[model samples]
Target chain A: MPARKSAQPAKPAPDSTRRSEKSRRAIYEAALALVVEVGYPKTTIEGIAARAGVGKQTIYRWWSSKADVLMEAFLDLGEQSLREAGPVPYAFPDSGDLAADVKAVLRATVDQLRDPRFEAPSRALAAEGVVNEHLGRELVAKLMQPSLDLYIGRLRAAQDAGQVRPEIDPRIALEFFISPLAQRWLQHTGPISYEYTDTLVDYALHGLAPR
Target chain B: MPARKSAQPAKPAPDSTRRSEKSRRAIYEAALALVVEVGYPKTTIEGIAARAGVGKQTIYRWWSSKADVLMEAFLDLGEQSLREAGPVPYAFPDSGDLAADVKAVLRATVDQLRDPRFEAPSRALAAEGVVNEHLGRELVAKLMQPSLDLYIGRLRAAQDAGQVRPEIDPRIALEFFISPLAQRWLQHTGPISYEYTDTLVDYALHGLAPR
Candidate 1:
């Protein structure tokens, strides 16, 4: 769970609950918009509050720092993306055919990356992370680590099935599936497509050298 | 060649040439420092000139814009790094054993990425490129493309030697060598070291699947 989630859940009346939900959504939208517009360094809580039509104290009430707000906002955005992708409780697909399962996940990622709502704010935050080491590590730990864990879990399953080499480090092995696509997307090195991701899966699983 | 390279070579008097060389080195240092300190958007030609103790006209005489100056500065820095690595004419070594050759190149790259002078300025520029599509494309074209080409060439050579599958696209195949390292360096996803990179080579060359 995110560190900022309230330890004691507030039990409020229906009207107050609805109002808080509305305010929270507005804050998320405002934070994402501000980061996309002004970039991360120039984005302030005051600006987010003003844009959200909420008081600064309200933002402080929920989150301790701008980083916290932005991180949570991004997490919300990712959740929204996952929900749009399908039903609740998305798990990394493990159909026993490791290649097909990984390809499906990577295809979904390509779709998420191409989403207009996710692209701009994500690029802004990712760009900041590239230069800001503290923020970069925070992004890795908070934003990316969960997905990485899923990849590692799936790989472990493949290992158990005798589909993957047991001695292989899933951590580094997983990069071949994601990093190329990421470099292409973030650096504008090449076009991203399902076919491209499928190729990554093939190359990573089967090896580039003749089998 | 970079677009800004002079079409005609200038023949200047020896004393004048020495003065120009000194001024050029100062400008390159100033541009890199400004980008690292103030970032790309805030870095101006006036700022670079002021720092370099040169007039704005001196900058305008050689480069059309700040982008040109920065790109040339980075190219110069890369050459300096290559020179420091050893004697000139650094070719991608093809020692029959493709893995050993690629590993050596990647190790040298690790050294370059860890260089104090290269790291900050490179991170600053790469961060800017992530958000700025046009600049990102330019960076890929002018800075990364040559290195990518060398990788492609080496992979092609390996294919000819039957070390790699002839059916594999060299372009995508090469990403397995570089993108993981690039992602780790740019995003702080993992610790970078010769060992980590060597492991990547082994995993990539030999399939992660039990062979």
Candidate 2:
């Protein structure tokens, strides 16, 4: 779907398929790098092409705009992250201990956040999304929703097992697990650590009032 | 401090004090209008000056940059909101009921978020802050700090009365009340309303766990 937006049908000729794959990857990496260095507004296909050492025609032949390239680039980064997170990382662990499983996932999230490759571009994209409604919704739909769905699935499982109160809406409940960390990173309000995420998980699972 | 940033020391020459006040108000309105319309990047001192129908020198005589002008305008907006909230609005109601007090303040926040005068410009500035770290921090200090301190104070009172866990960090605990709502607005994830905020209050206080 994103490639459809990119207008790149991956017309991998039966011959130049290897070359096409190389060019596509080079474009994604270059787009991510440029966005981080110069920001989204200042970045362009020309800039990405020059940086990637590919011709502008090659870029135009595939992608429609800088936004499309960047979106797909970020998606690629996320896919890479999932691959790095070990096999089946997207599948939330159901150790039948909801709190521990959530904590484990959040801790992994903490590690990914600390990873420098993701930090700068993410900040740039998130910052732009804050101002740009179209881009913001696109990010929520393309980048954020899949991960959110995974959380929803895990929470539903917890509800079925009676680990969570049946009355709670999993979508909103998931915010406690993720939004705090997201806000801290976006706002620079606090340091992120395993400790902070673990605390959020605990506070979220147990009543903050006297138990 | 903000007035200092606005560079408008109250020295209002005995003769032009009223005129000065009028000009300052016009400048604030113009700065806010321009930012909402053109966004922070395109909003210029020159544009604000043109829009306000004042000479460039008039703006130069007061604020230093577009950021300073916008900051003062936002501060003015916050003041107007407080005024509308009635006298002593800054005081979070204690009434020996933490949940009720927090809910009251959050509901007021919901109204403020929905206010047309606040929403567009606020979103514009908030979006910029996400990408611009310096502006982001300044916003937290100038716009967010006083309200945050109020939350801290009220939570401290709750802790002293043993209403909340003595070990709970109010700073972190308070996010449960606001960050989810903030994310919902910033990310376009869901609808915001008194009913939704009330649910957040209930969830954050009682928590997702069975009591």
Candidate topping DockQ: 1
lDDT of 1 at A52: 98
Give the Cα error of residue B151 in candidate 2, in Å: 1.1
Fraction of true contacts kept, per model? 0.90, 0.69
For residues B68-187, could you state the per-residue lDDT of candidate 1 as single tens digits?
Answer: 899999999999989887795768988899999999999999999999999999999999999999999999998999999999999999999999998899999899999999999999
Candidate 1 global TM-score: 0.97
DockQ of predictions, in order shown: 0.88, 0.62
Candidate number of the best TM-score: 1
Model 1: residues with Cα > 4 Å off, grouped in runs: A1-10, B1-10
Name every residue pair that clashes in candidate 2.
none
**Model 2: native contacts recovered, as a fraction:** 0.69
Q: Which stretches of candidate 2 lie over 4 Å from their true place?
A: A1-15, A42-65, B1-14, B55-65
